[model samples]
Target: MESLHRDDEKRTLRRFLRRQRQALSEHEQRLAAQRLCHQLKALPEIRRAKRISLYLPVNGEIDPTPLIEWLRKRRVEVYLPVLRPFSANVLWFVAYQRDTPMVRNRFNIWEPDMRFSAQRQNRLPAWALDTLIVPLVGYDANANRMGMGGGFYDRSLAFMHRPGPSPNLIGVAHACQQVASLPVEPWDVPLTAVVSDQGYVRRTR
Candidate 1:
């Protein structure tokens, strides 16, 4: 059943993402992103965090540009994840600024400098973060997440939550991406909350 669920979830995600990508009539994609941004602008979490880590947005990905701008204006320390280069499966978080230069990765998504990316960026203790905003292919109101089959975020968050000093794990997604329920593996890590154009789902229920 787990394997079947995963397959179904992947197929659904692929179809939804592709349709979302296609629905954009050039300017529509930009507008959709902007709408998503506008909705998140009023979230208490986005308004409160001092130290935050976020995955850089990619194609048809919910744009974090507005949040990033807000963070910069408020003098919050913002970080971005970078998949390591040269045979490392770990992720690293690097300090991001408006001026931080970005180059495309092998997958064609824009990423921060590999030299300062998440895994290679720093060795700071995990408990130092106040909040983390994760991206997911699909998620539910119950905080269950279905990622792109990589457990980097799961392993990292699980490790960070072991003792004291763990940050809140927030997820950002489009309302369309929300599922009613999802398959959970032993390694899956639940999020604290989720924000979408539909507003926030606190996930405490």
Candidate 2:
């Protein structure tokens, strides 16, 4: 079996996903996104978490912007990840209320104001985050995730695997991002669950 890190496999998948991302008409993409939103709304895991961390979309990844908006309205304290300039580590934080201002950063990703974070940040040990909604290129029911090779999330999860304080780690992918299986490394963090437009699947291995 080809491993995910295999240069050929990653290249092949990169091209495939790029084409797939471009082929979707905006309407089709948004509808697919809406379906995913609906499916997620019905998940007990989401409902159970009071504090959550999510990412701003890049490429055509399922936009969690809508979910973030709704979460705040429901009084759910939500956090967004801020990747430090030139650093892989992120400052996961809250303060993205509907009224929060966003500015285009050098990375071209829009970010919320720093004022949203506390003057004295909680900076939970990675594992202590109640729920981490991770982004993925491909995932399978086995809880494996294929990322862009940045190793940010992987390292963060590794930090969580310490003696105590690891929270539920879930991968959020588009229905199209699912694959037959994915290759994982010893240091790779297995996801607790994966959710797509189709539904949620827990990896039991």
User: Which parts of model 2 are misplaced by more than 4 Å?
Assistant: 1-5, 85-91, 115-125
Give the runs in model 1 whose Cα sits over 4 Å from its true position. 1-18, 85-87, 116-126
| Tens-place lDDT digits, model 1, residues 1-205 | 9789877867787577546644556475566567766766676766788888877666566666666776778988888776655534456566776677777777676767666444355433335777788887777778777776667687666675456556778777777778777676777776788777566677664
What C-alpha lDDT, on a 0 to 100 scale, does residue 39 get in candidate 2? 72
Clashes in each model (backbone N, CA, C under 3 Å)?
Answer: 3, 0
Candidate 2 TM-score, C-alpha based = 0.84
lDDT of 1 at 69: 76
Weakest 10 consecutive residues of candidate 2 by summed lDDT? 116-125
Q: Flag clash pairs in model 1.
A: 92-118, 92-119, 93-118
- For candidate 2, lDDT tens digit of each residue in 1-205? 4553496777688667656656767786687678777776777777777778787877877765567756666677776665544556544444455566666666687766554454126334355567878788787778688887667787667765567667677787777777788767787887878888778788788
TM-score of each: 0.80, 0.84
Residue-level lDDT for 124 in candidate 2? 43
Q: After superposition, how far is residue 77 of candidate 1 from its true place, in Å?
A: 1.1
Q: Provide the lDDT at 116 for model 2.
A: 43
Top of the candidates by TM-score: 2
